[model samples]
Target: MKTCILTTDTYLNHDTGQGHPERANRVTVIIDHLKKLKSKDLIWKKPTKFDLEYLAFAHDKNYLDNVKDSFPKQGLNFLDGDTIVSPGSKEATRDAVGSILTAIDGVMKKDFNNAFCAVRPPGHHAEKQKAMGFCVYNNIAVGAYYLLEKYNLKKVAIIDFDVHHGNGTQDIFYDNEKVLYISTHQYPYYPGTGKNSEKGKYNNVLNIPLPAGTTSEEYLDAYEYVLKKLKEFKPEFILFSAGFDAHEDDPLAQLKLKSEDFYNLTKRTIRAAQLSSKGKVVSILEGGYDLNALKESAEMHVNALLEF
Candidate 1:
């Protein structure tokens, strides 16, 4: 089966203002790079509208309402200290969530063996009632909840490899045994939440925190624990909070992962999914600065997905 690529033109409309790292160009660059591949097996599609009910699975009603009400008539409004929203941001943010839902539907229906969502305002840091870290909604968390509620899937795995920890995702699923959240990120970093001792109430959360200036070899070595945890959990579906900012070129953090490292990570993660979840995987964008590194790393990631 072909791999589905979920995106929307609305993403370009969610302007992050000048000098912000999470600019609209991130998704544009990824889309442009993917298009250049000219791969026949790629099935590109725009995201469809999703019911607000799906979003409620991960976010609070008041929070959603606040986000809806916060969109400025013109110019920009800040959702939090870091996240910003313009009038266009409402549609763009909804489209980001829609991209994940559409990707999930495609995978569950067997329309594709796997899918990749390249939407932006990346969603790993938005918690139940708070929007932060350039994230307005917890997109992947909602996708996982949708799978559990709609498909009755008993076990799901969320693997996050962003340079920064996915604290919001962990917060949403910390008590839910059905969803397993595993993350590898630079320690003492932004938001400062993922600690080795911060295992979830049900022990469903696994965090592998690497120190600053970690090398590619060290990062992969730590990733083995993630692979082992996923294997042990044996989930029915796999969700990836795929972030490429660990690349040495990224301005955000101090990890030194090379472009090829993303390919290896994808290969290993795919193999684990094959073993535990029949190759059912949905990868969503989280964080990645350095346009060249983001483009190259994303291409390598999709190349591995296509290989499967």
Candidate 2:
């Protein structure tokens, strides 16, 4: 089966102010690069609208109402110091969450082996009640919730490889034994939440914190913990909060992972899926600012998905 690509043009309209790092060009560059591949295996699809209940599975209803009411008709509004919203951000953010739902549906229906969501307002940091770190909704968390609620999956694994820790994802799923949240991120970094000792209520959350200036080899070595735990859990579905910001060229964090390292990481993760989930994997874009680094790393990530 082909690898599905879920995105929409509305992402370009969800503008953060000028000179901001998470600009529209990040998705633009990634889509452009993927188009150049000319692979017949590519299945591009628009995001479908999902019911609010899907989002409510992971977020509080009041928080959803606040995000809906926070949209300004003319100027930009701030959800936090970093997360900004414009008039168009409502649809863009909903689409970001919706795209993952659609991708999961496609995978579960056997429409595709796996899928990649190239939506914006990158989501890994948004908690149940607050939006932060340039994220409006916790996309992968919502998707994992959907899988549990809709498909009746017993265990789902969420793997985040962003340079910064996925504090919000951890917050949402920390006590939920049905979801295993694993993250490998730079220590003592932004939002500062992914400590090794913060294991979840059910010990379902595994955090492998790496130091600054960590090289590719060291990063991969730390990833072994993720693979080992995933094998033990044997999740019914696998979801990747794919973030390319750990690339050496990224200005956000200090990790030195190259573009090819993403391919290796993804390749290994897919193999884990083979043993655990029958190749059921869904990847959602989270963070990556440097245009070239984002583009190359995204391409490498999708390439590995397709190769699998």
Candidate 3:
């Protein structure tokens, strides 16, 4: 089965103004690089429109409404200091969420073995009622809800590898026993929420908070905990908040992981999830500032996905 690459063109219009780190080029770099590969096993697809009601399952209805009203007719509007939206952001935001929903449907329908969503307005930092960290809609959180509500799946696991903790995703699933959220991130960092003590109510959240200078070896060792938890939970589906800022080549954070390490980490993850998820996986872009590291690491991650 081919691996699906889900994306859309509206991301180019998100327009975070001049010189924002989370600029449109982030996804553009990855998508352009992936397109260069001459692999026939890759299936490229655009995100399809989805229902607004499903967004409510992951965020407050009022919050969604406010977000809808917040889009500016022109220029940029800030949901918070860092999260910005422009005239095109309305469609860009929905398309980001829709990319993941479409990827999930493709995998579930067996149109592909697994998938990756290359989108922006990077989520996982946006909480149920608030947006932060350049993230607006907690895309993975919505996908987890889709698994439980639409597919009737009992267990779904979300693994986040962003250099920053996925505070928003944790907040959304903190009380939901049906989903397990795991993160490997830089502690004492931005958003400042992931800690060893911040386990979910059902003990479903596992956070492996590493220091600023954490090396490739150290990070991989810590990853064993995430795999162990996944094995114990035995999730019926898996979602990845794939962030490459952890790469040593990245500028956003201080972790020292390499590009190939992403390949190894992804390979190990899919292996561990084989029994539980039956190889059904969907990853979405999160954060990776250095364009070179972002492109190379995303390709390595996709290399692993293709291997399976």
Candidate 4:
């Protein structure tokens, strides 16, 4: 059982314009760094072509139609103040979604034990009808729906370790009992949504909102609660909204997690849910700004996936 790395070159075309933190180079650095490892334990793969109806699993019909129409014919178009699209964004966005679906199919079919999608135009912030926070479509949400609808999965869990809260993911699964969405993020920060009190309708959502300047020790300590919750839920499948911007080097937020923290937390999460999930997991790129930090952290994350 190997770990798969799913990605495509289409992400290079989803231009965000100049000086944007969520640039195409984010995935470039990660893919470049991972390739340097030359690890035989990794199975490199490209995202397979998938049905466009899968997008509707996460987004509204009108919203999806609007997004399809919003892609520019030549230059750039803004989906929101921060979420931008270009001529190539049409392919990039669909490829981003396709990457996850392909990864999910691989894992479910045992072609790989797990996967990490190094993709741009990161999802997790796009809500049911609105695109925000450098996200156009909720990729992981659609993956969860695919698990339920396509694979007939009954218990699915999403762990979001991004610096900013995944308000969009929480919004989509708020009332859905079969899917559990947990997020640990710097609160009262950008987007400002991950309060501990914002549990979902069926109490399926858990938000561990930490204050800025939280250190590696403090963040890991808080992560124990996440593990405890996972143990209680005993999910059948697990998905990670892997984000590394919490690294101290990241200019995005003030959380002080080191690169190795991702490995430790991921190892713990995999170990904690081993019995229920059978080591079945799929991770997708979300947010990580500092190139060096993102590179180091994503490598550490993959190391954990390779190990377990």
Residue range 1-308, candidate 3, lDDT tens digits: 59999998999999888989999999999999999997899999999999978898889988999999999999999999999999999999999999999999999999999999999989999999999999889899999999899999999999999999999999999999999999999999998999999999999999999999999999999999998999999999889999999999887799999999999999999899899899999999999999999999999999999988
lDDT of each: 0.92, 0.92, 0.94, 0.94
Residue range 1-308, candidate 2, lDDT tens digits = 59999999999889889888999999999999999999999989999988977888778999999988999998899989989999999899999999999999999999999999999988889999889999988999999999998999999999999888999999999999999999999998898899999999999999999989999999998898898898889999999999999999999889999999999999898897687699999999999989999999999999999986
TM-score for each model: 0.99, 0.99, 0.99, 0.99
Candidate 3 clash pair list: none
Cand. 4 TM to true fold: 0.99
Estimate, for each residue in 90-166, the C-alpha lDDT of model 1 and write its tens digit.
99889889998899899888999899999988999999999999999999999999999999999999999999999
Which numbered prediction scores highest in lDDT against the true structure? 4
Error of 3 at 71 (Å): 0.3
> How much does each candidate deviate from the true structure in C-alpha RMSD?
0.8, 0.8, 0.6, 0.6
